[model samples]
Target: MTDWARFLPLSNRDRADDGGVSRDRSPAVASLLSAIAAVLDARPDLLAAPTLRPEVTVDAAVRELLSELGAPWWRRWARGVGALESPRPEVAAFADDALASALHARAAALAGPERRASIHDLRATVVLALELNAAHGAAIVVDPLLCGAVALDLALRSRLPERAVVTARSLVATDGEWRVGRGPELPAPGGAIVLFLAGRADVPPEDSAH
Candidate 1:
């Protein structure tokens, strides 16, 4: 078993000595990336549709990362690579070549210090790719327990939005070691909760509160 506790605190951890990722978290990060690559490689059609975000499809997001990682601020602003007006299915070759190009050019590291461009972009992309794959009913190699735990940890540390008519509920995981918020009991699987938070409308009712 991977010593997941190494990612504890989830907020202050991943302090890599080289400003990329810590030695421990590096392999985890790489594995996550490889998993994403493998999925997209096998089923390039997964890139055919838009994600929940209409303007931000998987292809557009990947394009954005390619342009922005390690680029000058003006270059990033100039490209505005995300959010195409009419997103369409990119060729499989584009996906393969683009990913390889990113690996060669983008100087991002594995996890994060909350500031490295690549890590930030790549981490979010990894989650996105995996989520998209799962949304399409594909089997993922990563453990659900780990995904939920990390998602919950990240959610807790994020700033809460204001002007909600109802208070936030305390989510108690029926299948993992995580809980967040503080209202009624929102019992659900960890991965399900993460999906719902990402605005995934397809989350099954069984994955929601009882």
Candidate 2:
């Protein structure tokens, strides 16, 4: 597995060598991204709908991940919303809207009033997730949303390689700092990528977080 912890903010020892501030990582971050990837991998068809928000894509991903992880009941409800092979565009759009609203509400409730994330932030969050996937490769988890963020990034990276690289750098500088808590209640695995998105950074010569 990727040494996910090495991506977090630098420790005193780490700073002693790097001499700069770094981003932090948490378990919620890992689970959230993993969930996002699971959903997208399961349903590439969503990409055909350009009007949908990233959150809608995320909701689909989350539902698929849950089902794969043994939440069959959720899978049933999720399928009722809209299946990948749904025959009607109108029906699929309606289901997408419903699922997106549900996900927005749940994310808001979890974030609470203190750190309630805006739709814009969520949208940007999705972009960050996609960029990581692109840089690191989707299959390996890149040590890694918030929808088209990945799709859009992938498109740009493919067409304008240099510009896309520059944009990705700017994204890391801005989006990289934000962290997701996954709340304190969820039972997450130790050393899992948690509480925030990942960015482009040099790997340490040796493992540090363990």
Candidate 3:
């Protein structure tokens, strides 16, 4: 079983690395979503309508649900800081990861060969998920768990906006960092710019040469 204790809320005894994340990441993700919307806006002819924000609130709500399913470790710690209940933490973590990973894999498969760009979209989506998860400090489980959560999040969030159609790849963090490559632009015609972002995995062997 995967060692879920690493991500089980306040399981981190260090306290310093406990259930916390970078303050800037939320806005960064919001900006990327906004950027995608902006690009879609520029190509009125391609889409049937203007771009809109994805209903990511729903996904966030789900995460909230997960948090509430039982008292999160952080919450418990904040209250009094006691020992964990130890309810098959490894199994739960493994199950969550498996489900999330499958979701992303299916998404990639659905991209279809007609649009190579969809692959790129998938890449971006995956990268965004990893980055967000890492920033939130939720990536304490295994790759499967991290990948799965990210995939499910993207699938739920992509429902809104222009439905421009996107896909993502497996996010592997190299050197103790999240590594990713943004895919090509949407298949929007015209001389529109195709933008993609790449990142490193959140593993070991840190790449200090930026």
Error of 2 at 134 (Å): 6.1
Cα lDDT, all candidates: 0.48, 0.33, 0.30
Candidate 1 vs candidate 2, lDDT winner: 1
Task: Put the candidates in lDDT order, highest first.
Answer: 1, 2, 3
lDDT score, candidate 2, position 173 = 15
Candidate 1 residues 73-190, lDDT tens each?
A: 4544454455432122332335444663443333235444553333334335445655665556545564544455445444533433411201356545576545544566667666
List candidate 1 segments past 4 Å from native.
Answer: 1-24, 65-97, 100-123, 153-167, 200-210
Q: Write the per-residue lDDT of candidate 3 for residues 83-193, one digit (tens) a residue.
A: 543233432353432333433333343344432222223334435433333333333222332333333334333442211222333223231222222233222200011
In model 1, residue pairs whose N, Cα or C atoms come closer than 3 Å (at least 3 residues apart or on different chains), thus clashing, are 170-183
What TM-score would every model get versus the actual structure? Answer: 0.56, 0.25, 0.22
Candidate 2: stretches off by over 4 Å? 1-8, 12-62, 65-94, 113-128, 131-210
Q: After the best TM-score superposition of candidate 2, give how far the Cα of residue 66 lies from its true spot, in angstroms.
A: 7.0
Query: How many clashes (backbone N, Cα, C below 3 Å) per candidate?
Result: 1, 12, 28
